[model samples]
Target: MLGDDRGQSNLDFLFGISVFLLTFLYAVTFIPGMFTPYQPGAIDLSAVAYRTSAMLAEDPGWCNSTAAGGLPGNSSWEDHQDCLLRIGLAGDRGHPNILSLNKIKALESLVASDYTLVREKMGLNGSIIYDINVAVEMNGTSLINAPWPSASSQNIESIERVVLIDTGKELFVDCNNPGEQYNSNMLNVTLNNLTSRDRDITIRIYNLTAAYPIGLAQDPIRVVSLSGNAISLPPDDYIIKLNGEVKNSTDFGFMKGDVLEITILNTAISDPIISAVNIWANSSCMPGRPVDYVYDPVFKQKSVCYPGIMRVEVWSYAFS
Candidate 1:
């Protein structure tokens, strides 16, 4: 009866032992979660915070003027709004992680005037309300400041994103800035707080293969000074160089592809710090036309924007 009955081969013993170990490990991992008060799946504020921040940073929200416009909506929602579809801070879809100054200002205003509306606009509508906080720091200065709740939350998640701001005012053009147009005939810039010390201004007149002079009597592109700033200089005031040849005046005009660089050195302003700087430009500065000018897009108001860090925090009380 016991003739060739080997109790159990080594392979069989090993297989059984492996199965027992796996089962024990599973029990150890799963059993604790079953008893714990805070399960991973129960509620996650961190996930919400990540999602919300992504929406605000990457997606430019839309505001509808009317459904009849046949245009679903526009990213320029800050200025126009018949219906608020969503609340986002990004400048546009083409560019992400760059907040629009207009939109940021609009959101800050909304938060202050209508907190509940902001939550609704952000798609945080539900029976269980969420306490949300948003803040933006630009160039180490607080641009949008919304304080967090004083009461401590059981579950709190905070996220920050480094974002560029599209101020819409081109101050300095190194010829390599993103979204720069080479054939751009007209140039507009804002110079703030020009010191009494000598200030250098460089302008690149692009796509002038025909060599048109920037200084026309009525609509001159070579404007030496700004409004209310006592800076009046003539063509001779600037050092103009084109194709390795320096010329005080572009009587023959400029050529194409190769640019003309005009450097104008400014005298020091008075002791008082200048709050802002502005230039007036011709509305029609498209290449191929005999027109180019530079001016502040926002003539009356001072639009000062800088790169900023946008922070979003989500908080909720954990259920005991």
Candidate 2:
């Protein structure tokens, strides 16, 4: 009877050991799949790409407040990296996603000099780094392609932002008619009552070949006014008189004679920031390069504005 009891006890002990081994094997099989964390880096990478795209498309950007020898805002931001606090392309001061050509150029210059600076400015840090690519597309073709040096085999995470480009268009006015004459050399351009929608209007006065008269050759000048009044400029420069007071520009030189070309340019106009372009001219229309004015091939006779789509692209390979 004692031997039988011992045998029964041994059998029970073996059964218990077998059950424990089976359970242990089952748990070990699933340890890698169930106990280990999934790839969390993917979520982080996707978030970073979206955040960068938003910053470029939405932020109006900021300049260094302390004046570290850098030009502040607009076209002046080009070439002065120390001055830029943020990088944005939007134009409408209040609107996001609208691109500004001036700001685009500024950022292009900045990134070209050092792409790492962009990542730092974007608040990216730690072991993860990124490769960024910015591009502008129109009609399925790339207009502007800016990218950092990156390997093609590296996994890339990319995002795109749609944007509108601010461009210039050519405008022609016939001052030969006596009624259109503001003076013998100047023509009257009615402001079209563009209250809030006013653009940066540029007026260039020259001859048939687009030559500025001898004494009137000078860079384009900005003039603004609300009521008709005489804003005197130097002799030998173009004359453009607007209703609003000039906000930011120097007075150009103009000469008194038969006017050839009277071009008016206005940018997206808003209160407290009215901008206009005025050039001086006379009958001679001699060709000369003004510090401010340069010939653009887009226009055959004079300067004009053209609209384009700005395509901004970003790429990251750290976790992608």
**Structural similarity to truth (TM-score) of each candidate:** 0.49, 0.45
RMSD of 1: 12.4
lDDT of 1 by residue, 1-320 (tens): 56875588899999999999999999999998776547443545677788889989888898876544675777666666447788888877777888887688788877877777788777665655677888888767777764434436756788999988765432333333333333543444434533332344455544432343343222233332434453434555456666547764445343335555555545322223322222222332323212211342322222224678988888755432
lDDT of 2 by residue, 85-127 (tens): 6666665467676666556766666677777877677666445
For candidate 1, give the lDDT of residue 278: 22
**CA lDDT, candidate 1, residue 225:** 40
**Native-referenced Cα lDDT, model 2:** 0.48
Of the candidates shown, which would achieve the greatest TM-score relative to the real structure? 1
